[model samples]
Target chain A: MKTYSIVLLLCLLTPYLGNAQENFIFKKAYDLKVLGRVSEDTSHFQRIDSADLQNLPPAVQRYAKFSAGMNVVFKTDSKSIKIHWKLKKMNTLWNMPSVAVNGIDLYGWNGQEWQYISSGRPNSEDNQMIMVENLDGKMRNYRIFLPIYAEVKDLEIGVLEKTTLSPPDTALVPSSKIAIYGSSITQGIAASRPGMAYPSILSRRLDFDFINLGFSGSGKMELPIADLLAKIPAQLYILDCVPNTLPEQVKDRAYPLITRLRMLKPEIPIIMVESVKREISNWNSAMYTRVNGQNDEYRKTFDKLVAEGYQNIYYISTSELMGDDHEATVDGTHLTDLGFMRISKTIERYIKDSIAPLQ
Target chain B: MKTYSIVLLLCLLTPYLGNAQENFIFKKAYDLKVLGRVSEDTSHFQRIDSADLQNLPPAVQRYAKFSAGMNVVFKTDSKSIKIHWKLKKMNTLWNMPSVAVNGIDLYGWNGQEWQYISSGRPNSEDNQMIMVENLDGKMRNYRIFLPIYAEVKDLEIGVLEKTTLSPPDTALVPSSKIAIYGSSITQGIAASRPGMAYPSILSRRLDFDFINLGFSGSGKMELPIADLLAKIPAQLYILDCVPNTLPEQVKDRAYPLITRLRMLKPEIPIIMVESVKREISNWNSAMYTRVNGQNDEYRKTFDKLVAEGYQNIYYISTSELMGDDHEATVDGTHLTDLGFMRISKTIERYIKDSIAPLQ
Candidate 1:
């Protein structure tokens, strides 16, 4: 009877309560458990080490500063979530959506898998938006993926004042990670949001973390990039740079880059991915010949390495990469969220087979 | 011997020839066979009639002017194709890619299916881009889907000089069409490109044209819209406006709209689609309740109409609309290309079964 009266009193006062923002307690996202990063010394949410910028290409250095695949993980019992983030600049790409380039994507762990909650829409450089509201106030695990192609200055998460907000008590993420190195597609150019990138999708499905070393328009299998990648420790490495590299460049550089990486990280596995067929190649004979030539060169290099007895090296072909229908990309070159899902599904099996024994 | 000499001569001169655009004859897109439009009285590419704007809601009138699912069909033997278009104004949505909003999507008839070729990327109000080059100079059928959410002032298509460029002689598109009416998702919001929208996707796969009457934020099942939809002659009609209508609004407005449409277009099939489950509803209590309530109300209205002896009315549940995974949308609300694919595939079977007898 006493509980009934309290419920009745709460129901009566529910109409009078207004402006939920006034009841929130804001916390810096930096204090939370961060994932999808290799280095922790950086003050901001950048993917690459700033100290190594001098050795990298100009485009790589600039692309590295953008938070491509970094995300924050925490558990909260707040009825609502509000996110406020400051981007260094409003860097909206022509082909990609602003939500993917600068906005924040939120996901919640629903016992079985991480389900999408909502997105924080970015209207300006300094933007604040509510992710979700009027929840049941139950303790839930949440991860918020940062901007895919924008430099984040700072971020804060707001929850109800009375609710508890803290890091995970159990092991939600694995200690070892899968590091991917590739071009603009890997950098999440045309994904609807950051979390929809192939690496992020694979991470969520496989319950692992991925260090995305994707440099936009600069994943050309350069020796400097190879040197940098070899230094970052990981369970496996994915090289998807054939799209950006010319056929001659592939034939010239694939051997040196693979040999150097294999020499440095002998115990780890490296999976070489062939570039997916460009959609325009269906009609345009030039793209068809060019892409096929690039893939042929890449395959020959992979076969040569296999012949040389590289034990830990693996190869992933482009047959089932983006499916039979070539409607996976926005432009003929870059993968959309649909393409990302197909690629992630295709690559997930290879990742699982390679990493199981090591894990 | 003569063919071999000609081939050798062409190969020799290939290196010297520069700027392929210089050897092209430009033709206005309006002269070609236009598809996915109901009225051709308008001077430009528009889905809806300007004469009907006074009867629509203010937002609907504004949205109707945009070329959402319109396309031009032409046959060309040119080695390359170039497109130049002028937009009334640049209308780039934050969540949607500009390629989808303002750019053109090209597809080719590859015997069995319409395969993706390339997309013309939009940069500004006046934009010109090369769609493809270096083809085999074979006679090929092509369709270029117009911008999904931008107004086209004028459009021109260019083909190589001394090559045949004309409209399709064969019936590439059927005279009878499938007309769809819905909210922003149906209006092609957040798709990777214009061709990736559900109606456009279905049209290609089903081998039929579709009149897209999707209005952003204005598909409220208004009496005026039903009156307008009833007048358009088509093989079938689809009502997918549950996402934009309130539960009470569905209960109040749905019966009147459906009855009016059925009364006017007595022979055509009317498919009522339930609102797709929003991704945010998985966690947000308010959205969960609201969306479920709206669907329930919509379903109940359909059941009532069925019980009252409506013969040609059909109902489609939200069972497999966007798949089980909630990654189909950029936000929790609007669909991405992945979501559009899922929706199109799910709805295709129902459309095929309904329109088969009529055809």
Candidate 2:
């Protein structure tokens, strides 16, 4: 009985004992929050207000709560950095989430573009933290990409003891808050790491602070969502929710969402994206119909908006967004890392030409 | 004492009393093994004989045991299909082990191309059998792609009770046993799933049986590996080991390996490949130097081989293999799905034109 008790005690105390390095506290990201970290709440996890959240239907509210692309930027002088976070909930089995789903990717701004640094993994007890060691100590600029698919309940960052940590020049990041509302692909699936997601890639490449309003399977452009989105101050609004809605739903909701955005931020660039065509659609005419019809709605809506004297509204057709080759998708729908890169590259030109900076 | 005994008993019994559909037994893969199923061997997990294995050095021998594209072919009539496999060891921390290091993907041959079905995740315990349910009821074909970067101790298939599972048309698969030997990219690192790997994609695209001898960091073209690879009766031998080897290593091993291959199979085609260049190489000139120098070695070896009257030897330059764009890789180094697709398309033409079919 004594032996058994001793074994159980050791098992219980093992995790708490930790490594030689004392775990430091994760400071509040006050600067990044002001720059526009788009979690539902002020912290890292809520989508909308808990009171306002209840008014929506159960499914939409649940989907909205997912913390996709909600990241905080901070600088640390330590050679070792660690990520600490817990899921709102975990799906242990089924679907087999991609590597980037719950992982965090770190990128350093090398004066020009964001270069890859390292990835952090969860500890043995997954909810604890994953640590990365041996970062270059030259006080380089850094970005910690958030989870793509999962809902992060809390996120904290820690560096080695006595290391100086400071906030980066917010000017180094894009001055504009770029709000992109879309579906699963936009939420960033099949990317090997979070930084590889199109939006995340664009954030690094184009130097934009971003709001990923990508709701997997449920990002049909609802009026309530549009109303809520209008409250946030954005320099550019990207509507890419075509893939999740039916042709009829797109016809009804697509224009209203843009109208709402135009009402609040009339001069900002609002780019309406045609659903990226699926690989199977080339052979399957039914799939072709769905893809073509959805894009047709985008063209019609853009024309209607333009006729009404909405000058800043723009449109992107799917002609070459994913490239001519049919190898861009993972499951014929979601973008892989390659697909994400193509999307980022294709979108960069339009963004540069149309946004506030260019205008 | 009684309470302790009861608690222990429950721990053992809980997994068995799992969700209603009891995890069925994995059907034995009678094929894919020349030496009996090594999982049961109580030795290291190897698909080939230990006596022949001693010819290679220790490091390569350990890598050779990983079952990358090694699959067992079978047809089934059940409405559901399940996969059961155990890893020799498990990593229970971050990066989650779902995308690259260890994961399984199922592909079905739909007469023309290989279609993606589903991916399997382990049960609560990482080592337990992974089950995939709800497959088509018709007599269909399947290729269960094994882990790309991990060792598979055991693997088996499971169908619903009393369902018919028979051998597929051997001709429906590629008649030419294509032996491709390369590095981690060939082993499908970051492909989201196993079937999306270049070798696996090409197999489905061309309807060919394949042997993927891609070792992550161990693919140095050693004489022992060439001696062993010559033993297999391959229609075409793809030597893509350049990515892992340096220019000096290539200069030393390139001609000798091809010479060994030419001596064994005089008429068969042998395609030598330049390593797909990294994304960072465009700006980072040092990277450019490495990639350029490596391809130069490939050109040199191919020239030397052809001059010696080794006729069926061919070479693919880096220009078209990974595409001109820098967005094809997951990391700067590893190819993503887009990269894989581009590679397959580029190689397909070479395979058909260089091999007897196009001629």
Considering summed lDDT, which 10 consecutive residues are worst modelled in model 1 chain B? B9-18
Candidate DockQ scores, in order: 0.40, 0.11
Which ten-residue region of model 2 chain A has the weakest summed lDDT?
A9-18
lDDT of 1 by residue, A235-268 (tens): 8999988877777778899999989998888899
Once fitted onto the true fold, the runs of candidate 1 whose alpha carbons sit more than 4 angstroms away are: A1-20, B1-21
- The C-alpha interface RMSD of every prediction is 8.5, 13.9
In model 2 chain B, the worst 10-residue window by lDDT is B10-19
In the range B1-359, model 1's lDDT, one tens digit per residue, is 56643433332112112245366788988788888877866666888878877888998999888999898889999888888899998887888888899999988888787888888878899988778777788898888999989999998898988998898756686677888999888999879899998899988888677999998876989988877887777889999998877777788899999999889888889999998887766776655766687789999989999899997888899886989888998887788999999999888988988877865
**Cα lDDT computed for each candidate against the true fold:** 0.83, 0.64
